[model samples]
Target: MSENTINAVTRRHWVLIACMLSMFMAAIEVTIVATAMPTIITELGGFSQFGWVFSIYLLTQAVTVPIYGRLADMWGRKRVFFIGAGLFLLGSILCGFASSMGWLILFRAFQGLGAGAIMPLTSTIIADVYPPKERAGVQGWLSSVWGVAAIVGPLTGAWLVQHFNWALVFWVNVPIGIISMLLLVRFFPESREKTDRRINFTGSCWLMLTVTALLTALLQAESLGYWTLVLSAVALLAGWGLLRHERYSGEPLFPLAIWRTRTLLAGNVGNLLIGAAMMGISAFLPTWIQGVSGGTPLQAGSALAMMSIGWPLASTLSGRLMQHTSYRFTAQLGSLLLIAGTAMLLILHRESPVWYAGLSAFVIGTGMGMTSTTFLIAVQNTAQFEIRGICTASVMFSRMLGSALGTALMGAVLNYNLMLRLPQYSDPVQQVMSPAGREQLKPANLDLMLTEIAHSLHWVFVVSLIIAFGSLLMSRLVPVQKPH
Candidate 1:
């Protein structure tokens, strides 16, 4: 090979490596913290504040993503991407040193501020470098980052906690993030473009407040008591104000025209439903398997892993489909697969084998893979470069928003059914079922409580199946785009 050709290949390889590492840092945090939560709470001793560690990161990321997306379009990709990586690294360092849960949550929010830029910007950068047709395949590979993270994060977290301190979980991101940032600086290139410099700070504030209030309310619905209602109201009012502001602002944070196209409209709706259903399943599937099906934790994890496996495989396959077929068909095919998987879920019983759950998960994952990959590629194809970043960010934000809301809704369903059906034993049953509370259960009532827990989880799966079907219905509305 010629030296110039080898150089080009090397640059592309480094870019891909940087993208994967950056994406992994952002994605793995979502699950890696799960294994360390108990350890964190034990050492920090603010049980009530533990959820904030995760919640704050998600809330900050969701609200700020669009702002970063808009900024990326205005200032160019390199600066925004670097800023995000820097903030993320800084946050990781701070989190590692946090003296309390509150401090850790604050640091995590900082990390999320950086992450807001990372997720959308990574896709945008990929879009910038690759041709339109090749983007689908590239994105398919990128989508696997989440799957790999899902499988490895918990184990990595567990190992770190076992061998060292829980603080290492946060600290670990520092080196990887630094490497990613450095790679971008040394190798990544972008044209310095002149564009509209005016930023709608007011609109951004409104968005941040709106998303924070909304996500917090959803996340805390079961525990927030009357405060949940208050936050929900604030969210609604803020959302209304945000809409009006964005509609009138000189430089709207999220362009209103993107929502006008049938392709974007349908894609957004489908993405939201897909994200919602997927999140709901991930959050509750393990509980259902273990509590209802008498499966071991390993079995429960394997069931979830099946979905992870299916997602990337389908994602990779959809790109080839996009080469010869319409986006609508691939999307619909995915939706149907998901619906079929959910249907499988509906029939699961206490006697079902663990592999049965895994099989259902695999099918749903396959559908998710195809559906998400198709919508992203379709949305990008539908817009010009001027608004591509915003459009891309908007799609991502929708999915995150959906996942947050879906999780809350599913949790409510699970808890409500448990309370309603086993009123006499609800409180004690919930307590004993918790990891720390398992040993506290009265020896005589243990069997009865387990049975009740299983029954309640069955109802939760039923609710999840209904929600999954909703995604299938939404997928039908997505307009098919012929491959260019």
Candidate 2:
């Protein structure tokens, strides 16, 4: 190759690496908080509102992803990315100093808003720099970073919490975010689709309102029975209005033309289901370890690490294997493994061995890694270069929506089961229910109730199995193709 060509390739690779690292940092930040949540909640004294810390972040992130994606198509990727990184850093710093759970939740929303831009742009930038044939392997490398982050985030969080304070968990992101912002500004190329498109403020408002309502309904369904129904109806109406606006508006939030492709639609559906399952598992695993297996915070962190290990390993191997096989087959195989892994979760019980649970996580992670990266590759390959950003963003939005809904639903299920079972336990047994709650439930009659909490999680596992099967079914819609 010519010297100039080699220079271009080197620059592209460096930019890709920087963007991937940023994405990894954001992904890890979400999960790393899990290991330290118990400590944080105890300190902040807001166990009743613990779920909001995660849900609010997820909700804001989900709403902003598509908006950023659309904006990147209009303004530029580098500008949007840097703005996002700065916002993330600012939020992280504020989060570290939060004196109350409410403030922490608010700051986390800012963090999610910034994180909204990271993942979609990472994929879009990759597509911008690489040709179709070479993109799959590169995407796999990016996928592996998530695994790395998953493993590192929790272990690091646990250490910080043990040696320093829980606030360090959020503070640690400051340096990483600053470094990523500097690298992106220095190395990333500015890319945008030139257009005279005007911003659709009304359409954007409608879209936001629609999603906010829908997410609120889903998240608060169990808590506010009447409000759930009211919000659901309003959301449906607003969603219909948004669709109509998009269909007719000159510059829509998401171009209606992209939805015409079957690949994009199918990939997004599968991603939504997969996202729900993935987040549900991620959120619950640590809780299960601490509550059921009676593991320490560090041990719980380590068990979750198995998932990190399994995903990246499979992603790296799948990258090489994709060179010899088709995306469809790879995705199918991955989805099947996910189904099998989730099915195996049904065997997990309070009395089950810890290794067995870890094994299940590894299997599930591997399957997720294979299917997610492959689907991303498939969708990118199917779309035109100019519209790739929006297409990729759409898939990510679906995943976020799934994650938000899943976290909310799973939280409700866990709480419901706990409440139902808690009343039956004697004080002594209930005292062992949760490390955070142990002191409050010290009555002697709660012992039997504590044991029953273990069985209630079985219902959660059954729900997860249903979600995994849904993902499998959606995977079949992906058309099979041989390696080029």
RMSD of each: 3.7, 4.1
RMSD of 1: 3.7
Best by lDDT: 1
Candidate 1: C-alpha lDDT? 0.81
lDDT of each: 0.81, 0.77
| Cα lDDT tens digits for candidate 2, 1-484 | 1212322544676777687778777888877898799889888888888878987887788888888887777777778887877788888889989999999999999998898898898888777677677777788788888877877877898898999989889888777767766776776656765678766888889988998899878875766789988998999999999989888887888766567776777778888888888866787776666776677766766766787788878877776666677777788888888888888777777677677778888899898888877777788888765567778898899987887678777777776776777754443222463676765555453345546666666677777778888877766766677434
Assess every candidate by TM-score: 0.91, 0.85
Predicted candidate 1 versus true structure: per-residue lDDT over 58-159, tens digit per residue: 888888899988888877777888888889889988998999888899999999998899999888777766667778888888888888998899899999
Model 1 compared with the native: what TM-score? 0.91
